[model samples]
Target: MNAVGVIVEYNPFHNGHAFHLHVAKEQANADIVIAAMSGNFLQRGEPALVSKWKRTEMALKAGADIVFELPYIFATQQADSFASGAVSILEAAGCNSLCFGSESGNIDSFYQTIGFLKNNNELFQQKVKYHIAQGNSYPRATALAFHDLTPNEDMLDLSKPNNILGYQYILSVQKQQASINVFTVSRKNADYHDAYFSSETIASATSIRKALFSENGDIFSVRQYMPETSYNSLLEYKEEYGHFHDWEQYFPLLKFRLVQTTPAQLKNIYEVEEGLENRLISTALESYTFKQFMEKLKTKRYTWTRLQRACVHILTNTTKNEMDRKVEKASYLRLLGMTTKGRVYLNKHKSQLSLPLISKLSLQQNEQIMLDIRASRIYALGTRKNQQRLLEMEFKQPPLILN
Candidate 1:
């Protein structure tokens, strides 16, 4: 049996996601679909709208056969590292292909861009350093350097979010010299950042999340945009938990963490560089809200998104040394949930898996698992429930099995 892989957040499984899952499986002609999903924190440096377990349940109900947890270390980083970690896990799981949604739906362009970067690596590195020295953010600097080197308008589409991540996925596979066939599903209807609901059947995750948390959010209105099964699951979860988390709820804890850390200590945190710690410390002290602190810290050199991720690292005490250790030690595939078919797929491939597959809580608290637990605790802080009970859910929850 063959399986196709996807790296997803599902943040809250909606119609667009179900469409993509349908296309991925059909295009690959695979027997099963495996998803490597983000944990409590997403790539955007905010807590997921729903817990990973809830998201997993949604994915399985929608179409996915299995869900694997993408460790917090990689899930919170920028596109390249995030893709590398996700692809590594999928490859280790013995997937035959990788499928993802893209804005341009052009696979050849991604390959061309990757080839260009590899061939001009030395020059590209020099250009990136020069642009950074000139006070441009890393992402912007890289885009500027690409423009200078290739001057192709089409190639520059790599700057778009989905396309950028798609490029990274292919690049990561090449770096590992793995033979995973790649497929791109053209994105439909809503754009990635679209925050308004335009229809009932198709909308961006952003739009769904915005509506779900808005003051006027009504279940009847929100239900129209999601599959019936997904909508029901979300509705059940909301009724029990009140609502999903918003980033604002985590502000107090983040502020407290920032207040206690000195500049010297903050300097050693992962992704903290070029005196960013000073800015974080000073701004955090002066600003009371997460919004105010982010506004004060945002600049041409440091994007708001980057600053938000930095705050997450500090709140969880994730330092550069620790990040490196975790990255090096990410050798196990942690299972989150699976469908009946997914279980069969895994059992068939068990002997061929390159990494140890973890399906239950362990007695040993390793560095990587510890960081994930810490991230979960921080995410739980955003909820109104008892903190200890929320933490206990991490240990008590078993892999979701969908018949």
Candidate 2:
């Protein structure tokens, strides 16, 4: 009855993800796979191609036993914040180990990097700040700072996307002093950010998303790269919602928010800072599309991902104070979907679990969940269908139990 936890977005449950899930379960030698998945929005600050529920179904079909929603606040955050929140939830779910896909397949390298940085904490912090002051983005700043520390060849490469996230996952587990063992599996065929498909059976989620969007939702074009279950879910979602969710789909509303809200007010939103409001306002007024706006908005101080996340905060009207008040650790595990095996594991572990396991949104009353609620409303807003009907589903819908 042992369980292993994986931090995932499953933006579309493609072949690469299915591979990771299976390998993780096998490596951990666990009976159940618990996934801490991002909701409507992803870590890169983009809306998901499909809704969380649809993705949950894809996960269950792909082999995950239990799927938990990583709250919006954490889901749309940078790697460190994102990892910390997801790790906390998995630990709270009573996982015996954590498994992540990384460019550096060796788990020991992540431990080496974490321990090396922990011993050089002061210098590392100073270097990061110094880089930020020099107009580097947070990820860039961290990469520079990591280089400044001169980590050994045995250390994981913080420059790579998966490695950076994996490093943070292990670091988070250690910082929280959780008893979960950590493991890593090597990414195969395609890297995390690969934008072109080169492999026959494996492709990066980015490449799949790009292909799907560019092909105008021709699911068959990318069908070879994802499981049939994922392909079917995409078809179902397109039928019900009319189209897949993306930042381009949300741009008009986001532009409206940027134009209407005063710069002083934008400052209040989470992640908005340092006269960025003024810059964003100017960009919104001139640009008709998200792509045009992003082109004008890109700066060395902000990565494309960071800027998108800030834009997400703006669109959701999530304030700095609201995010600041909530503890970074998991106070609750919001169950999105599960298989019968998953339900059994939960029922057996319910009493021993440290956090409340929430299945229905209406039943859980916590301030931390408010951001998630707001995110869902915004996600529904992106759709062309009955907005109110979609919003209602957020509350009325129970966790998807895959039998």
Candidate 3:
């Protein structure tokens, strides 16, 4: 009845993800696999290419026994909050371990790095501030600080996407003092940021997204790597909806929110701090697209992704205060999909669970959860078909079986 957990965006659920899921199960010897997945919006501050429900179906078909929605507040955050949110949810779901993919598959190195950061807080903080003042982005500033403290050029490279997130995961586990064992599978095939697909069976989510947006829109091109159910659903959805694309529809709303909020209020949004509010307000007024606005405001002190996430926080109304107040402990275990064995495990552990086990949508009537559900639907304001799909989504049951 033991379970292992994964935190993912599955942004399009490519071959690499399938490999990770398989490895997670094998490594943890888990009877069940649970995933905390991103909702409509992803951590990178962009709308998901596909819907969360569809992604959940893909995960279940690929190997996950259950999937829980990582709330928008946490999903759109930086590495730290993102990891904390996903790990907290998995822990609450009573998972015995967590498995993730990392560029540096060395867990010991990650632990050592975390230990160093913990012991050198004061010096590290001062160095970080000094780097920021020298006009480096937060990631760059962090990298510089690590180099200054550790005197190792290699450690600074940990700012690369997967390594940075991996560090956050280790830090979260350490903070929780949870007994959940941690394991990692080496990332394979394509690099995380590589936009090109390879001939092999495994590919990064970035490459898959690029292919999905390419002129052909051919699911068959990557069919060999994806679960049959996921590929079929994606093709069917694309055919009916002409591809769910872009986050432009929400731009006006975002602008309205930015313009309405005062400098002090903007400063409270995650990633928006230290006079960055003025830049946001000024740039938002002039720029047309979200990407363009972020590009215009990008400074040495803040990376593009960080600025993008801050904009998302503004659009979603997730302030620092609100994020801080969110219960760090897992409060509920939401069941998105599961197998028979997974169901049996849930039934057996239901009484022993620290949090309520959420299955039927009717059971989620709490104000905050309800608001998140509504926001997810609202975020799907892409196309008419998607809009209709969102409006009708409440009636759909969790997809427990592959088609």
Candidates' C-alpha lDDT: 0.85, 0.89, 0.77
Task: Give the number of colliding residue pairs in candidate 2.
Answer: 0
lDDT by residue for model 1 over 1-403, one digit each (tens)? 9899999998788888999999999999999999999999988888888789889989999999999999987898998889989999899999999999999787877887877788899999899999999999888898878877975555637567898899889888988877799989888888788899776588888988888777897767778778888888887777666677876788888888878988899898988898888888788889877878788889999877787788889878899987783352256788999999999998889999998898876648677787888888778777775556667778888889999
In the predicted model 2, the residue pairs found to clash are none
Q: In model 1, where is the ten-residue run with the lowest total lDDT?
A: 322-331
Model 2: how far is 79 from its true place, Å?
1.6
Candidate of highest lDDT? 2
* Greater-TM-score candidate between 2 and 3: 2
lDDT of 1: 0.85
Q: What TM-score quantifies how close candidate 2 is to the native fold?
A: 0.97
Question: For every model shown, what is its TM-score relative to the native structure?
Answer: 0.95, 0.97, 0.89
* Candidates ranked, most accurate by TM-score first: 2, 1, 3
lDDT preference between candidates 2 and 3, better one: 2
Off by over 4 Å in 3: 151-157, 215-220, 256-270, 325-327, 361-364, 394-403
Model 2 alpha-carbon drift over 4 Å, by segment: 215-217
Which stretches of model 1 miss by more than 4 angstroms?
153-156, 325-329, 363-365
